[model samples]
Every structure is written in structure tokens, then in C-alpha cells.
Target: MLPKGFFHRRVVLTAGLVLGLTGSAFGAAAGNTATNKAPSSTSPVGSTNVTVADPTVPRPPGTPCTVQLFSGVAFNDFNPRPYAYAPPAGCGTRWSKVVLEADFSVTAGRQFDRTATLWLGGVNLYFGTTEEPSSTVAPSWHVERDLTDYSALLRQAGNGQALIGNVVNSTYTGVIYGSARLLFYPASILAPAAHAPDAVVPLGSDPVGNTVSLATPSSQLSKSLSLPTNVERAYLDVFVQSQNADEFWYTCVPDQYAAEVQECGGGNFREAEISIDGQPAGVAPVYPWIYSGGIDPYLWRPTTGVQTLNFMPYRVDLTPFAGVLSNGAAHQVAVNVAGANNYFSATASLLLYLDPHAKTVTGQIERNTLVGQPPTPTIGDTLTTDSSGNITGAITTQLSRHFIIAGYANTSHGRVDSTVDQTVGFGDIQTFTINATTYRQVTDQQTSSDGVSQSTVGGFVTGKYSEHMRYPLHLDVNQVTAADGSFTLATVAHQGDEKNLAHQLFGITLYSAKLSNTVDSDDTLAFDASGNLTSHSNQQSTQTFAFNDSLGGCYRTDVGSFSGAVSSYATGTGCPGQQNRLFWFTHPDGSPENGNAVLGW
Candidate 1:
């Protein structure tokens, strides 16, 4: 049964359809060591296909003790699979690093893309979506994440669940199976464990079903906790995923024009807002994530959208509120999607660091200028209709916000002041041309968040951190019905995720990095008058990823495919000296470097 507001495009003459970090440095250098690997090729009609991606996580030099969280667990129903988790004993608790790895596969058959999530101790370890399977292409893939920051939670034994909601019946026959494990790297004389969060707090629903559904701006996923009194720093890692009608939020129009353009409403703007005890704390810009079965599936054959298989959570610094949260009373932390329609799935975790020397501390919020809600967007609609009922015009929506949050905490060392200044901006423009013979829609959208945080003691700056991120998307869909009733559907899409981050201490830059990933694709589908698909052609896609850090670590890869087969591959083209290489070393102060490096991307 389709849920309310669910939008799935189906054409009857229907022939069948369609469908669609980090670690370690042990010697991080910045050059390409080898050629880029080719992407997996599409399998024949009754076989399995291997979907591939370039490796993004850097590994430390030490050997790791592995702990199996779950093995060959099948997900053929809505019930989440439960599992037991215990830290690896041999590796010791104070390890240099921790990593999570998982593998998933689906039987070759028919199935829609499903959401996948893993939770341990009520905290989200992974969140992503599966690939759609076809009669000829059963797909398999692997994903990994660095969990060093959540080491506090991993140190204790716990129970968790893996959720990959699916249905298996005579129809929708695909079955998904998965396995996951954690790798613990023990600290050594040369490579010691980095400073990790002292406490971890989860802001989610009940256990197992660890995510909350927010149907509107007023809906929130909140948790009340009695935190430690000496809290010195705090951060929240948040994830907001669009579901049901909100999946294609960037393509939606204002409510009044929904029926006119055959699109969803609520405008094309969504942002994740965070609050502390009813007061605004911070904002996280939403990324326009496209799933495997979104739009024209053919466009994502050999390469998928950026972060489609593995999502990177956005981190919101809540350090300024540390004093208020440590006042000995239970405080509430909440999250919501500002423009959620139908709904959005949300989850978050709070990380806190306490002053080791002080058993108790005090502080207060000095100033808070962040509003609870974003300003109303400027909506411009120039759509026009002729006497024949044909529609032609453009609709544009844009919004921008800027604010500052400040607070101070008294610790054993001294009184420290923390302030955060941020700016968020969003813009979406869509143009439509509709008539009896043609249906065309084009959309261009961009979202960005830029912020900086600084810590000072006695009026002297002690630390500084800055981050900048941007998401850009462009899509064009055109369909034309010929006089004989036959029709052609063509689509062109370009999507990107880009980010830059840096940290400084005592006026010296300690760490800095830059990352960019993009995908571009186009395809055409033809159907006969009987509504039967005749052919699909002009299928092409490409993905490029580039990353560099001040420590001298560098990685870059480009993969291209045509007609469902990988055709070209390259590496290190965008790195320093056009070479791909990675080597990292941590400084005594816990700052990381790829090599003896300067502070720049």
C-alpha cells in the first residue's frame, strides 16, 4: 500500500518500467600511488552485478582486532534484526582508532530501493539506501565509517539492530542480506589514541527503531538528559533524510502551483534546526541526496549520486551551550526539519568532553541571536497559462539566514568563552513548459552553510574552527508524444557535494582539508503507442572524487561509463603534482597531518 503523499510516476502503456573518512596516518603523503580502478560492469540477464566505488577511508599502520557485529543477516520483512556487540578484548579499550565496515547484497529480481540503518546503544552508526535490483542485475556493495569519535559508546557491551525494511512476496521478490564488523586498532608507543569524547548521548526514538519521523516543522525528535556538571565542550551529529513525498523536495513547487506543475508542495527549501531547552542552538543545511531509483534510473548505472550509498552526518557544534547543559538539571536536545512535508526521518547523537581536573563547573549563556525559525523565503511565480490550457513560466524561491551564538564556562583552568557565527543560504529555480504534445521541466538548486567557531580565555583566542559546505543540483526532464502516440523521455542531471574544513590553535593552523564529489548523467527512453518500452539509449554517466588535506594526504579518482559498461578511469589528476598518495602523522597535540605540511587545502 502506498502511503499518503507518496509520488511514484507510472505510465500505463506500461511496459515495465524502470527503475532505477578517515583515519590514519600512520605516513600520509600526497601523491597517487597507482592507477584508478575501473567500476563494475553490468552483469548478463541472469547473473549478479558488482557495484564498485573508490576507497575513501584512510587506514592506520597498526593491525586491527576485528569484532563481528552481525553475520549474513537476511532482511525480508519490516522487523529489524537484533544483534549483540562487545568491544574487541584483545585490542584493549583505549585504542588508537575504531572503524565500522559492512557488506550488503540483494538477489537478482525486482525490488524498490530501501533505507538502511544500523544502531548501537541507540546511536546511529550508519545510514544509507540500497540499490534497486533487476532480473539481470543482483547488486552487492561495501561501506565503511570511522567511529573513533564515538569510542565512549563502543567501550561498553551493548545490543543493537540493523534495519533494512523490505517486503518479499510473489512480486517484489528481491531479498537483501548483510554482514558487519568493527575493527579496533590498539594504541602503541608511536601511534597513541587521540582524544575522544568523554560522554555520548543519543537523541532518538525508542531503541531498535532509532529514528523519529517529523511530518512538519513542529514535529521534533527530542531527548532529555542529565549531563555531567563539568562539561567543557559539546557537539551534535545529525542526519535528516527525506522520505515519501519529500524525496524530491528540490523539484517541488509552492503549494498553490502543485496541481499546475504536477509536483509536490511546501516550496523547495528544507533545513535541519537544532535547539537546546526550547532555545535555538544551531542549523544544519540539508543536502539534496538522490536515491538509486530516483528520477531516471538509467542515468545512475555505473556510478551513483554522491554519498548515495553512505551518508556523512553533518556536525553542529553546541559547545557554547555547555554551561547551560551542565547546570545539574535535565536538559532537552531537539531536532526538526524546517520545511518537512509528508515527512523526514531524523536522528542525532551528542558528544561531550569534560574538564578532567574539575569535578564541577558553572557558566551561562552570554548572548544568543539565532532565531528559532528561518526567515520567510522570497517566492516568485511568473507562470502563465494560455487559452488552450498550456502552461509556461518559471517559479523561484530563495532564502538566507545569518546568526551568532555565544556562551562561557568556568573550568579548573580558567573561564573560557566560546562563540559561533554561521550563515545559511538556499535557492531553487524551476521552469516548466507543458502542452498536449510536450511536457518539460527544468530545475536548478543550491544550498550552502558556512560557519566559524572560536574559543577564548582571558580575552585571548585559544582555538578556532571553520567549515564551509555547498550542495548544487541541476536536472532537466523532457517528454514528447508524437502524432502517432509514441513518446520519448529524455533526462539530464548533475549533482555535487563539496566541503572545506579547518582547525586552528593559538593562532596556528593545526589541520585543514577539502573534498569534492560530483556525478553527471543523461539518458533517453522510447515507448511505442501501446505503452510498451521499445528501447533505451544514449545512456552515459560519470563520477569524480577529489580530496586533499594540509597534512599532505591526497586522493582523486574519475570513473566514466557508457551503455552500462565502465569505459574510462583515472586517478590523481586533481592532486598536488597530479599524483595520488596518502600518508599521515599525528602531532603531539592530537592534530593530524598528511606530511610535514602547511595549513591549506
Candidate 2:
């Protein structure tokens, strides 16, 4: 299951993927952070920044359907047990946006350290502390993960099967509980021109499974899939995870781009670089996964965890490359682990949206043309460390660099052009400890800017975009445990007033008018050695825009406000809505898990 939106990543290359990219990687990048910064020479800024839509596309009508396409099964063992989901009743082909959702919960007092996963077709949806989220103590918990990108597999065409399993925990007191489903939002809500891939081709291995660890260098894997004919749009959807690789990437790479106050050493900030037949395609950022930390809760999880649970995958809109790849030939699509480490692991798929009328599609790879890339990043000198290998030191990345990638897809539909600019102008400094109870202080000031432009056969059927984010991040996470086994996971994450302003020019109206949303969240989660919990959190987000319902859009200039105050360790329903959704974003930029998407990658 692959995902996509216009302005193409919102500009992401995240934990190692490209932009919820306008969302985190540089998978997706961090979008909500820099909401108010000035646009760059390559960035799209302001309301007057009109978006042109395809004239021939149908005007959306009626309320979209939110269907439950699948119901997942539960698992408690790592025996590769399987779960299943069937689409909502009345499901049909008219669907446009589809998202996979999973709800999994585990109570405290369990000694489990394994991941829970659901696999459909080639797409994988992970639960628990798997993939990358640290599997530490928390309350009996339930979480909903989004998998809209893989809507292709949630089809009524057949019954979908998902495999569920977790690494065994000897203390085993709590059962691993969960289910999976898909939420479908009809195409009628979007312009008839809304795009959905006609074919989703799995390009790599792991249909069975593969481990991304030291056994595999850089966690690199490659495969080639045949392309469909008349392809007008395409996307490279990727999933990857690594345990114990978090600190290496987060602290080592410094910033995906060179920083100002400090400079990064070590070539660790390597992204998931892809190539088509040896030609460079795109880059996916390597995330400093929460699972990459030490022996904790997530050790048993898959890829640390999936994005819906804060873990994520990288996606590259192959649409720009659509023109050059529509030959319906067997093409070479490869994922590169340029990070030079075996901790990063990955699996990839290429999704294509067809244009039946398109007689041909072709394009070229031009790296550093629009969105420049950072040079090889280096890690700073290792600092003094404790007996447990917890290094107590500071990092100063002294390089300021920029990465640009630009190209166009030529097809019967005209040119699908794109230019992305990801700049790392400041320093990304971090201090961390890898003991049982971890600690980190990160002060990062950087910018990730992105834009995409397109036109159809008539040229009037056009698309334009601009999104520039200057996110300056300052956060600290201290998950400390006392000798008595009492522990607290305190996190204070702050995003300066910044805006990732993105406008998709489609026809005369603008939809999803999310703009300049300032963000800041603080929380302190505490638990007994047995994992009972009380969490106190305060979060604020303001998404301001001027469009409204009358415009047949949802981006009315407004704000979303929410807060929480809790100090007691309550179970089940006691904590209400105390969970911190720190990575939430809006508009062109989709969150790591869900959003309104115009282009389905």
C-alpha cells in the first residue's frame, strides 16, 4: 500500500524515508514545524499562489464513504499467525482515497519485547514497539495506525490476509490485542481528475521476509518489476526498519543537510536512495528510530514500528519519472543503502496510476537540479561514555548544505514537472544516553522546502505547488528508570512558529487549505516497573487559512486546540485522550499515517 499527495511530499525524506516528507524523512520530512518561514526561490508561498486543476476532471460530488475494508486478527506469538480484513459493505471501484487502519493494545506487566505486524499483499502494517518505537512500559494501550498508501491491497477483489506476530516476552502476562481495517474516502469528494494508481507493483523481496541487520550491510536489497503501459503517474513506496540504528542516524548524520552551529561527521545521515536501471531516482531519509535505542520494549517490534505508531516509511512520487517509465517494460528499480551501515533495512514497491489515453510515458533522473542533496555527512568524535556504552557528549555539525532534485515526466498528458529543494542551513546538535532509561536533548534548526508543477495535454489541465518549511526543532526525551523499577518517559518537543504552506492548483477552488500551523507539545509519562502509567501532556496546534466550506474545500483559516492534564495512573478509559500525537500535520503534507490526498502514490 503506497500513499501520495500533491506538492508531492508535502517534501519528505524521513527516518529514513522521503517526506511525510513535507511530513519527517527529508520517508517524509517534517512539515508542521516550519509553518511561517518565508518561501525560498524554489518554494511556493502565499494564498495568491493559485493552483490549477485538470479541466477535464469531474467535480467531486456527494459525501465520501469511510468504509472498514478489513478487520485484523490478534496475535501473541511470533509464529507468523495471520489475521484478516474484508472491505466495508457496499465497497466499490468508485473509491478514491483509501487508508489502512490498525488498532493494537497491550497492557502493562508483560515481559514481551516483540513486534505485532499485519501484512497485505506486499504492504506491511506494523503494530506495537516493533519497527522503531521503543517498547518501554506504558499502560494497557490501544493505538490506531493508518495505511492509506496500500489501499490497493484492501480491495473487494479478494479477502485480505495480514500476518501478526510478536517476539515472545517470558513474563507474558498481557495478551497482544488488535485488529486492522481500511477507511475509504470516495473520489467524488475530489476532482474527477483525482488520481489513483491502476497498478501497484512489488519491486523487491520479503514476500516471505528478510531481516535488516548487521547480517545485511546497510540493510540494502534490490528487485525489478515490470511497468504498466500508459502510466501517467507513479510512486515508489518503501518500508524499512532497524533496531539499534536510531542513535547512529539521529546523532551521527547530524542533519540531512549541513548545519550551521555544528557540523555532522560520519556518513550516517544516509537516506534510502533509489535508482531506476542505475540512474539515480530519489533519496529516502534514514530516521533515528525510537526503536534504534537500546534493549527496550520495541526490540520485539518490527522495523522498530510503523509510522501510524510514530514509525514510518519513505515514498517517492515516481510520477515525474512516469513519462520515461511507461514503456511497459521490465525496468530496474533499486533501493540503495548509501548510509554504509547494516542497521537500516528496507523493502520497496512501485505504484502506478494509469492514463489510458497516454500512448507513452518517459523521463530522466536529474539529481541536484532542483532539490540539492547534502554531501556525505560524518559523525563527530565519540565522546566519553559510561560503562554501559552510553556516551555522554555533545555534537556540533558545522556544515551547511543543500540538496536539489528536479525533473519532468513527459507523456501524452503533457509534462509532469517537479523541483524539490531540501536545505539544511543550521546545525543539528544532540546529546544522548543509551542506558536502559534513555536520555536525549536535540536542538535542530533547519529548513526543508519542496514544490511540484504539472500540466496536462491541454496545458490548462495543470498542477502547481510550493511548500517551504523552516522548522527549528528543540526537544528532549528522558526515559529514566529508578533502581526500584519505577520509570518515567518525559518528552518536551517544541517547534518554532513555522509554516509548511502548500497550495495545489486544481481548477478554481482550493481544498485542504491547511497552512502555517504552529506546533508545541510536552508530556511526561511515568510507569512502575510493571508498567502501570499516568501521563501528563499539553499540546497546541494552530492551522490558519482563509478558504472555507463555501469553496468546496476544508482549509478554512482556523485553528485546532487540545490539551491534557493527568497525573494518576489510570487504566482502560481513565486516561481519556492523554496520548500525544506529536507528528500530526495538515494539507498537502500528510502525516506519517493519514491525510486527504489528491495523488495516490
Please tell me which predicted candidate would have the highest lDDT against the true structure: 1
**Which stretches of candidate 1 lie above 4 Å from their native place?**
1-54, 372-375, 574-579, 584-601
TM-score of 2: 0.61
Please provide, for model 2 over 1-601, each residue's C-alpha lDDT reduced to its tens digit, 9 standing for 90 to 100.
Answer: 0111101110111211110100021111100111211222322212211111100011124454554434444455656544345565565654645544454444434332333445555455542242222124322223333344455555534433444344335534445555555556555423232244566666546553333332233344566666665776666766655433333344444343223212233433445667776665665544433331221221111111112233345556555566567666777887765544435445666766667776666766554442344335544634465665555666655444455555566766566665544443334666644444444445453434343333333445454444343434555655666777666655554433233333454553233333332233444544555544433344322223222122233322222333321111111121125221111122222233111123222
Q: What is the lDDT of every predicted structure here? A: 0.75, 0.41
User: How many clashing pairs per prediction, in order?
Assistant: 16, 126
Predict model 1's lDDT versus the native: 0.75
| Candidate 1 per-residue lDDT over residues 1-601, each given as its tens digit | 1112212233321124432200001011000101122233432222123333345455567898999989999999989899988888777888777778888888987776778889998999988877666677777777777787788999999889998888788767889999999988888876677578888889976764478889888899998889999998899988998887677788888899888888778888899999999899999888787776677666666566767777778888898888888899999899989888868889999988899999888899998888655556889989998988888999999998888899999999899898988989999999988887777789999999888888899999888888787899999988778878777778899988777877887879888878777788898877676655677799888777777778787877777778766676666786788877765232211111211112311
Residue 293, model 1, lDDT: 66
**Candidate 2 positional error at 106, Å:** 1.1
